[model samples]
Target chain A: MLVYLIRRIGQSIMVVAVMATLVFLAVFAVGDPVAILASPDADQRELEAITTRLGLDRPIYEQFGIFVWNALQGDLGRSFVYAQPAVDVILQRFPATMELALAALILSILLGVPLGVIAGLKPESLLGRSIMTTSIFGFSLPNFWLGLMLILLFAVQLRWLPASGRGETVEVFGVHLSLFTWDGLRHLFLPALTLSLYKASLVIRIAQAGTREVMLQDYVRFARAKGLSYNRIVFVHVLKNMMIPVVTVLGLELGSMIAFAVVTETVFAYPGMGKLLIDSINRLDRPVIVAYLMLTVVIFVIINLVVDLLYAAIDPRVRLTESKG
Target chain B: MSKAVLDVKDLSVSFRTREGLVTAVNSISFSVGAGEVLGLVGESGSGKSVTGLAVLGLIDPPGEIDPRSSIKINERELIGLPEEKLRRVRGKDVAMIFQDPMTTLNPVLRIDTQMIEAIRAHEKISEKAARERARQALEKVGIPSADERLKAYPGQFSGGMRQRVAIATALLNRPTVLVADEPTTALDVTIQAQILSEVQQLCSETGTALVWITHDLSVVAGLADRVAVMYAGRIVEEGPVSAVLEAPIHPYAAGLIGSVPSRNKRGVPLAQIRGMTPSLTNLPPGCPFAPRCDYATDICRSTMPEPTPYEGGRAARCHHPLSAPTPAAA
Candidate 1:
């Protein structure tokens, strides 16, 4: 087990290195760094000074080395647009996006899995067919479109929820709290819901497929023959076996949630890392962009690792063999 | 006679498909007495497995049981019983082991967890007690180091070992009726014989009514007390094992017995059943096997025969059974 852990950690470093290199190359390949550093109106000497100051005048390899070194030392450089530390800016906005993604993931599993199980357990029944049809439509609908629909229906039509922003105000212990604390959660709802709808549909489809596959497996038939209740067979035997593939899809979907949240955040006027990343891109905020890309990559890797751990937990076969090796 | 352990009367099952409602198991009537091994033999798609599944009320959606069909265990009707009650009856009163041990045991779970769950489902017992009983059951099925093996997953065991685990699980509850659906088909001949002997011993010791469903007539001839031969969703021939094997009256049954390789002499070619079993979706108006029967006459093609008794508790469903020819020296 210790050997396996060390091997996995070694592999992770190589993976991160590759990820960093690719991200660096892709970002730089789009345009000349000198052009961004120096505008046409700038004097030649001043342009050269700016290029040198920003390290653009240095060799690409040297610049990359410095960037990697600084990143490892927890310095993400200064934001090109905001003139603040890129790490600080990204960290500040990350919580909102994290909360949204987490909520969306939790909600999706809670709702989608049971729905999928029900549909799979009785594929030809009326309720099962209806769930199948609706989930298909749900999966096909665009996240942005679904977001707008939710906002239009709940915010514009019903006037129940605030259309935008986290909240109007906050209160604790019957005392009014500050805007920063109060407004965050109020604004989080619509955006989270918008993101969750599409995610839930994807999860439902995956779970449904996995459940159906597991249901047809011999063990499930054996469980049935043992006189296990339909509910027990479906939930205990079928659902547990089906989770491996569902977890894989869910892990990938969780990573994509941040990418998908950009559109959703934009639609809701929510301040999340997705929106921050997009704004950084539009403004050519190189430091902020680099910071966001690396953070996203790290999160993706972590989610996959966590999913692997979960696979081990849920399946003893994986655990035993993996431990042995 | 001892009370019938299982009484299946006029049971029919059909599946709803785009083409039409296709009957998989026609009206089949049979009963198993206590401690009797009633072998249900048939080729693929003969509805033997379907019949076993139907008895357990395990048929899922797309398949529906005909309301007219009734299955009684110990004189209590099992058809249309609430799922909760059926679950209680399953494993406890009646249990079934399926073919393919790898597929039969949940791969993700340990044998202990699965067996304990089965034991606790019908009985209120501590996990410790259940585990102990599970170990005993595994030992009874002849698994090596049974206690250690309970912690192992289904994949860790070989095909024969897994089937033994499955059989152990089925017998864990000491069910009165045990239905093994082609349990040995997935095994090699040596392991098959071993498991068969183990099952026969277990059945006689417990006096459990064993329903051994298989396509192998030879296996059933040795293992079963009585035999029922099914063809195209109906029982065509049934009698004592010796009677059915030695003097099969149904043409399909005769063909089946003749097709067994061991029965063929070295100099002569083996007898073969020509043509495939008809699709359930497009069954003929009369006998489902008529098109495949060499002795199929115009009347045989137009009308199906019901189970008609011959002497010695034997029955056959054929208008013209082949008369006994001069016996060849063994």
Candidate 2:
């Protein structure tokens, strides 16, 4: 187990390194950040001084080497747009995005899995067919469009909830949480609900397919023959067996939720990392762009690692097979 | 008979499929007594497995057990029984062992966890007690190092070994009836014989009534106290193992026994039944086997044959019963 963890961590490090190199190259390939930073009225010498100060005058490889060195020390350079450390700027916005993503994920799972299980158990029933049919809308409708529609319905027409922003927040253990308070949750509900609709449907399909397949397995029949209650059989035996596919999808989906939250964030005017990313992109803030790219890569790698580890814990087939190697 | 462990009468199973309602097991009836082994022999679609599943009340919806049918394990009626009572009766009063031991055991669970859960499912026992019983059950099935084997997952065990574990799990609760649906069909020949003998011995020793469902006549000849031959969802012939094997009255049973390779003269081609097993869907009106029988007559084609008694607790479902022949003389 220790060896497997070490091997996984080693692979993750390699993936992060490759991603970092690519992001660095792409950031440099685009027009230099010096153009956006220097004033048009400045003379050539003043522009040269600014370029030298930002180390843009150095050779690309030398600049990259220094970037790597400073990155190792947790410095992803300073954002010219914010005039602050890029990592710090990203960190400041990360909590809101994390809160939203986590809520969306929770909503998706809580709603989708049970609905999927029901649909799978009775795939031919009227309710099952309707659930499945309704899930298609989740797939067909874009999150941005869905977000707008939800805002128009609940916020515009009904006025049941607020339309935009992160609203009020309380600090606990130096972390901003938008959960529990009425104002915070009211602000959060529409965005989270809109984001979850598509993924929840995806989860429903995955869970349905998985449940259907696993139900046919001989072990499930054995469990039934063993006289286990339906609840026990479904929850303990079938649920665990089905989780392998669901968890894999969930891991990939979560990483995607964080990275691709741009549209939803923009739609709601939610001040999140995705919003920060958009502003940085328009300004050609190279440090922020590269940092965001690297951060996303790190998150993807970590999530994948966690999912693989969870496989071993949830399914002994994976764990036993790994131990043999 | 010592005591009837399981009593099933007029049990018919039908499935509501997209094409139509297909009968899988039709008006089948059989019983097992304590320490008695009943071999349910048939071809692939002979409803032998369905019979076993139906006996355990494990048949799900879209595949319905006929409401008129009765399945009583230890005088506790299974038909129309609520799920709660049915569950208690299942692993405690009767248990089922399935084909493909590789699939019968959950791939993700440890042997001990599965076994203990099986034991605890019926009885309220401590995990320690359940584990001890599981260990003993494994050892009973000839698995070595029972304690260590308990910790191993199902995938770690080979095919034969896994089957043994499955058998052990079935026997963990020491239920009165064990309905094994071709449990060793997927095993190596040598391993098949070993498992057959071990299961036979275990059932006798524990007084657990056994319904060993299989397609192999040789296995039934070796293992079962009585043999019931099924064809197209019905029991065509049933009797003591020697009586049925030696003098099968039904033509289908006779055709089955004749096809056994060992019975034919050396260098001669093996005897085979003339036609394929008919499809269960859209079965012809009268006797299902009449089209395939050599001696099928007008009466055979127009009317289903009821089971007629012959001798020595034997019965065969046939319009024109075949002449009884002794195995040694043949």
Candidate 3:
């Protein structure tokens, strides 16, 4: 297990390096951030000063080397727009996005797993078919549109909840959280709901598939024959087996959830890393943009590594095979 | 004589398919007394395994047990029993050991968890007590170092050992009836013989009725006190093992015995039953085996024959049974 962890960490490092290099080159290849940062009427000399100040005048290779070195030192360069270190700016907004993602993930598991199991257990039943039909909307409807529809119905028409923004905040353990405040929870609901719908659908499909497949396995039949109560058979036998694949999907989805939150955050005007990313992109904040992309990539790689470890934990067969390697 | 532990009467199992209603098992009746081993012998698709599942009330939707059918364990009706009551009876009253031991035990769970869970399902025993029983059960099945083996997962065990664990689980609660659905089919001959004897001895000691479902006549010849030969979805012949193996009355049963390699001359091609199994969805009005029976007559094709007593408590579902001068006791 120690060797496996060490090997996975090594692979993760290589993956992160490749991603950083690619993003560095891609950001540079795009239209210059200098134009967006500089005044339209700035003279050549003024522009040159700004360009050199930002290290734009340096060769691409040298710029990339400096970027890699700074990244290794835990410094993503200063944001052109915010005039602050990109890492600090992202960190300040990370909590909001994390909160939203976590809530959405919790909601997805709470609603999707049970519903998926029902659908799988009785695939031809009326309730199962209806759950499946509704989930298709979750998969197909765009998050932005879903967000808008929710805002229109709940905020504009019904006025049951706030339309946009993270509401009032409370300090707990030296951290300001919106989840505790009533107004903040009300504000958090719409965006989180819209965000979770799509993910919940994905969970439903995965869970249903996993449950159905495991239900046919010999062990399940044996469990039933052993006279296990329906509850025990479903919960202990079927659920444990089904969770292996579901956990893999959820781990991978978490990274994408952060990535996809950009549109959702923008739609609801939620103060999160995704919204910050959008603003940074518009203002030509190259450091912030590069940092965001690299962070997401690293997160994805780490999540996959964790997922591999979880597979071994969940299944002895996998553990045996992994040990042999 | 010991009381009958399982009494299945006119039991039929059918599945609702997109094409039509497919009868997997037609009206079949048999009983296994306590300490008795009844071998349900049939080829693939012969509904032998379905009968075992139906007895356990394990058939799910798309597959339905006929309402009129009756399956009683220790005189308690199993068919149409409520799920809650059936659950109480399951594992406690009757348990099943399935085919493919490699897959029958949950791959993720330790042997102790699976075995103890089976015990605890029927008995409200302490975990420690359950574990003790599980260890004893494993030891009874010839597993060495039973205490250590209990901690290992099913994937860590070999095929034969896994089957032993499965057997241990079934016997954990000392169920009144134990249905083994070809548990050794995936094992080697030596392992198969070992398991067969061990299971037979265990059942006799515990007085648990044992139904060994298999397609191998030779397996039945050795392990079973009585044998019932199934063709398609019906039992074509049933008698004491010695009688059935020595002289089968039904043509299909005779053909099955003949198809066994040991029955033929060493140099000759083995005898075989002619024709494929009739499709359950579109079976003829008469006997399902009539189309394949060499002695099939017009009467055989016109009407299905009910099981009839021949001699020595033997029965066969046929118009004309093979004549044997000697009569044997059950």
Candidate 4:
């Protein structure tokens, strides 16, 4: 097991390195950071002095070498806009996005799996058919439109929820968390629900398909023959088997949610890394973009490794192969 | 004879498909006394497996059991029994084992978990007591180091060993009736024979009524006291194993015995059954097996024959029952 983990970590390092190189070079190829930063009224000499100070006067390769060396020492260059270490700027907004993504994910799973399993077990029932129909709408409806509609209904018309902003936050262990308070949750409801809509639909379809297939397995019938209660058979025999793929899909989805929940963040004005990354991109803030992309690569690698381990733990077939290797 | 532990009468099952209601098991009746193994032999789609599933009330939506059919376990009516009531009966009075032992045991679960659950489902036993019984059940099926083997998953065991685990689980509650559907079909020859005898010994020792469903007549010959041969959803012939195999009054049964690859039947191409089992969706006007029976004639083709009794309690469904030398018969 240790050997397998080490091998995975090795592969992850390679993935992170490739992503770092690509993002670094791509950032350089884009719009001038100096132009975006220095004022238009500044004299040419003043502009040259700013460029030299920022290490942009050197050739791209020399600058990249220096950046790589500094990054190795945990120093991504300071953000042009915030004038703070790019990594530190990202860290400050991390909790907001993490909480939102986690809220959405947990909500989707708690709702989707049971509904999907029910639909699968009784695919012909009226309730089951309706569950499936709702999931179809869940998949087809755009998240942005869904977000706006939710804001319009619950916030604007119903006056039940806050439409935008991260409401009140309580700090714990130097981390900002809005999810603990009822008022904060009320504020968070619209955007989190909007982000979760697509995932909930996906989970429903995956769980339904998986449950249907597992329900037909010989062991499931055997379990029934053993006089296992309907609940036991459905939960232990059916759900456990169906969860393997769900875990796989959900684990990989975590990274994507943290990295790409920009639209939802924008709509709600949630202070998350996604919003920070987007603002930096628009301002041509190379240091921030490069740091964010590299961090995303690290997160993806970690999630993939964690998912692989979880897969092995859930499936004895995979576990056997791992031990053998 | 011991009292009949399982009595099935006029049992029929059908599946509602797009084509129409496909009759999978036509009306059939049979019984097995305590400690008796009755082999239900048939070709694929001849309703052999369907009968096994029907006995346990495992037939789900799209498939319906005929209301006219009656299944009794130990003189207790089972047909049309509420699902909750039937569930109590399952793994307590009656249990079923399916083909493909590789899949019969849940791959994700350990052998002990599966067996313990089987015992706990029927009894108010604690986990420790259930685990101890599971260990004994494994030993009863002749699995080596039963206690240790229980901790392992089904994937850890060999194919034959896996089937033994499934059998051990089925027998955990000492069910009055054990319905096995082609339990040995997926196993290798040696393993099949071993499991066959082990199961036979286990059932007789426990006084369980065993309905062994298989297409292998030879397996029935060795393991069953009586045999019922099905052809296109009906039992065409049934009698003591020797009586049915030696003198199959039904032509279809004769063809089946002849087709068994034995040294005695070798070099006899004439003995092989000529055609496939008929499709249930669009069957002939009369006997379902008429197209394949050599003695099929005007009456045989035009009229379906009800099961008729012969000497020594043997029975066959045929207008012209085959005889060794019937000079006067068609």
The per-model DockQ list reads 0.64, 0.74, 0.80, 0.87
Collision pairs in model 2: none
Best of the two (1, 4) by lDDT: 4
lDDT comparing candidate 4 with the true structure: 0.90
Residue-pair clashes per prediction, in order, are: 6, 0, 0, 0
On residues B1-330, what C-alpha lDDT tens digit does candidate 3 reach at each position? Answer: 367889999999999999899989999999999999999999899999999999989898889999999999989898888899988887888999988988999988888888888888888899999999999899999999999999999888999999999888988888999999999999999999999999999999999999999999889988899999998899999989998888889888889888989734888998998899888888888888889988889999999998787677688888878865343443
Evaluate candidate 3 and give its CAPRI docking class based on DockQ: high
- With candidate 1 superimposed using the best TM-score fit, by how many Å does residue B37's alpha carbon deviate from the native? 0.7
Task: Please write out the lDDT profile of model 3 over residues A239-267, one tens digit for every residue.
Answer: 98998888999998888887769999999
lDDT of 1 at A81: 66
Candidate 2 local lDDT, A168-212, one digit each (tens): 999988988888678999999999998899889999999999999
Candidate 1 lDDT over B1-330, as tens digits, reads 367889999999999999999889999999999899999999999999999999888887689999899998888899889888988898988999998876888988888989988998888899999999999999998998988999888878999999999998999888889999999999999999999999999988898999999999889989998999998899998888997788778889889989888734886888899999999998898888889888899988899887777767777788787654322233
> What does chain B score (TM) in every candidate?
0.96, 0.96, 0.96, 0.96
DockQ agreement of candidate 1 with the native complex: 0.64
Chain A TM-score (model 4):
0.98
- Candidate with the larger TM-score of 2 and 4: 4
Span of 10 residues, lowest total lDDT, candidate 1 chain A: A171-180
Rank order (by TM-score, best first): 4, 3, 2, 1
Candidate 3 chain A worst ten-residue window by lDDT = A169-178
- Give the share of true interchain contacts found in each model: 0.77, 0.75, 0.84, 0.83
Q: Please give the lDDT score at residue A225 for candidate 2.
A: 87
